[model samples]
Target: MAFFKSRDEKKSEEIYKIIMDTLKNRGNQVYDLKVEFQEGVVTLSGVCDSEATRKKAILCAELAEGVKKVNSDPLLLSEAAAQEQAAAVPPAAPVSPNPPIQTAPPAAPSVQTAPAAPVSESPLETGFPSAEAEAAELKPSPEPQPSPQAPETAARSAQPSEPVQPQAEMQTYTIKSGDTLSKIAKQFYGQANKYMVIFEANRDVIKDPDRIYPGQTIRIPPLP
Candidate 1:
């Protein structure tokens, strides 16, 4: 079997270098950082001075051309650093008071007149006669019943159901006595240089692309 496992190892090394370079270029310290690569995903694990640094690391990984995803679940910010960040920000300025409103001068006063006597037949007070009679007349009528919601039901029924699309099928192969990633890629995707795709996908199980032995299962992603 043509064995060449260094393809995966070399790829991992290159990805690690790129991640480190990106972190450095973005002003992140990588002394405590650990980078892992698998199936097109980059995992960043480390302690950062602040959440912003952690986010910057993830952003740098995302900006890398071949990275499909960045996992920062293992990244953390120091509690003291978080508290210090909160304490360092200055408070907002106070609001200014509004100017006083100007007003017109007071008008001259007039003489007051005596109150008039109440009329027994006034509409508001006594026209309806007894209190019960007035209350009966003033009682509000029953509210109208709401219309049936057929339009809403019809609108819901008119909505089209989304079609279900099948997920892309992944292929797997058991290594033969004499097989290389390049041969497998050529066999599956009509290109040997594209072996990196297979190596990346199977990095979890295949430590070295050139060293896989017979009967070892390997994933073969669909041709891009």
Candidate 2:
């Protein structure tokens, strides 16, 4: 079956492509940058030499037309990349015999974001298969439709399309062995009895408070 991508889906894909192109085409950054767009949000994924380059790539994409916002993640670091980045960002400030270490202006410190820890074993380690994954995989992959390959392509590709929709936020949580409702409640909601909130929100998968297995994915709900 052809993967028939919806207009919005196609647009999102084109946004991703544009972001990738900008990052790679930039100031001699040769690595293939990756990108994803969801719900009016743009997420940049790839290896860059330094935090500065990653930030720059994100900013360039944000300026691209149809970009709601940029989410920089999977920002990888390698020593070689770091050296290349340092050389690129600050070109030897006037060769003073003793140049003071130029410091970034005082601003809100960037929030620390670490990549998700790799699972030592596959998802099958839990001995339970993913029902949601099974359902998703059953559908025929959509048809590849003609859409924007880049933001510039998209800008002139379509006329007066519907507003880009936002991406659904999928929250994930891992279960711990010997975990009980009260323990989960205490950790997630601050009250042992608050386990009911979690239990209620996840009744679709959680049969009982005592039955949750380690490595299970549970959905947490926002307070109403």
Number of the top-ranking candidate, with TM-score as the measure: 1
Residue 111 error, candidate 2, Å:
64
- Residue pairs with colliding backbones in model 1 are 1-178, 4-210, 5-208, 5-209, 5-210, 5-211
**What is candidate 1's lDDT per residue for 1-224, written digit by digit as tens?**
89675543555667667767766787866446777767778887877877667777778777766779888888776776668777888887988898788888787687787888786784566444797877888999899998777988979888986543322578889989989999988877767888999999999988987888888898988855
**lDDT (C-alpha) at residue 104 in model 1:** 81
Q: Show where candidate 2 strays beyond 4 Å.
A: 23-27, 30-32, 50-52, 83-224
Instruction: Tell me, by lDDT, which candidate is best.
Output: 1
lDDT for each residue of candidate 2 in 65-84, tens digit (9 for 90 to 100): 67787777665656787777
Model 2 is weakest, by summed lDDT over 10 consecutive residues, at: 162-171
lDDT value, candidate 2, whole model? 0.70
